[model samples]
Target: MNIISENKSKKIEIEENKSKILDIKKEIEEKKIKIEDKKKELSKVKDMAKGEKEKMEEYKELKKQFKKIENEIYSTIAPLKREMRKLEKIVTDKKLKKQIQEYIEFPVKTFLNDSDLNVFRESIPNIEKIEKNPRKREKILRLIEYVLDGNLEDKKKEYMAYKEKVDSFVITSREENKEGIIKRKIDNLQSEIIKSEEKIKNLETKNDLLQKEILKSEEDIIEILEKDLDVKVQE
Candidate 1:
């Protein structure tokens, strides 16, 4: 071949090599762009995954807190519920039962404190004792006076007069047995018993109403705990 032909061939070869290099550079630039775009997409996916994980963790913690609240409510209320049940069994009167039901349905937190719980505990047993024994009826009457926010000074004077009259008649009758006088005395005793029974009924009614008021106030407290704090209390 001639020198011109050889030079021309060499130039053609160099041009071909340059074109291949350009193509390689273009492919590398495209791959770099694709890699950058993939990195961006991966970062977004990672961020979304992290957000989802955080939300799940937060939800789990919230559920755990709610469970704890439920447990606390149950623990706080269970003993009071048991005591209420015992009191219910002891009191057979319909009015007393209704009052006890109100107490049972009252809020868990009402009697949680030591002072309140002590009062409730003592009150139940005292009520039961007073109801069972005639001698303790006076104590119950006093409690009712306090509950009703009333002064019973006049009623107490009347009771004292009746008691004195009965005692005087008893002492006189032991010394002289007059049939007519004894009959009249028996009638008076019967009348006094009836009045005493009526007074007891009225006192019991007032006591029931006062207890209901107390239970309702406690019920409001329980409602706040249940609705706001997510505490579950057994009714």
Candidate 2:
């Protein structure tokens, strides 16, 4: 009876172990699927990036599409990570944490999930302590706010600087374009002047020919008159 009871207990323990293993496997598969989905989302973003054009109409449309896909990827990954954290919390398995670390510490798109995840994981031990300590939370929150506000201010300045530089570049380009147009106009005017000079030369030649013909006709009339006079004298 003792032997049978021992065997039954071992079997139950094995079954429990199997169940836990299956659960872990399922979770891992789900994570892999999510990773695959993220890869696909990245691919779509790349495709959208390739679709840009120099024309404002096509470029604006592509820009909008790219922004949409980028936002979707970011939003999906953030929530997926939060979900993963919740799942990790439920599993008591140590290997599960390692897997979570593997996924989170990866060079993914999220700031929270990248190199920072390990830091967050390290802070997991202090989570309960920090929660219990209100002052700690307040301190952390203040620090975060300060950092974020400073970053935003820096970004604003940088953006303004960039905008100014771009505006200057545009103005310079416009000036160059204007100069090019003026140069073309000047060249065209010079060509027109040459054509006009040629036309004037042609008109002068025509005038000289007309004048010579008139002189020749006058001489011929005078000769005819002299011949008539000579014939009368002879008679």
lDDT tens digits by residue: candidate 1, 1-235: 5444544555565555555555545555555565556556556555655665565465556555544554554454444454456566766678656655665776333323222233343454456543656656555545443423423333334434544555554565466544444355545545554554555556455555545554554564455545544533432
Q: After superposition, how far is residue 25 of candidate 1 from its true place, in Å?
A: 1.7
Task: Using lDDT, give the best candidate's number.
Answer: 1
lDDT of 2 by residue, 1-235 (tens): 3434544554565555555555545555555565556556555544443432233344355445545544543443343354345445655668656665554544123332243333334334544443446776565445334434443344334434544555554565466554355455545545554554555556455555545554554555566557767987999
User: What is candidate 2's CA lDDT for residue 65?
Assistant: 55
Where model 1 places Cα greater than 4 Å from the true spot, the runs are 77-235
| TM agreement with the true structure for every prediction | 0.33, 0.31
Question: Could you give me the TM-score of model 2 versus the true structure?
Answer: 0.31
Clash pairs, model 1 backbone: none
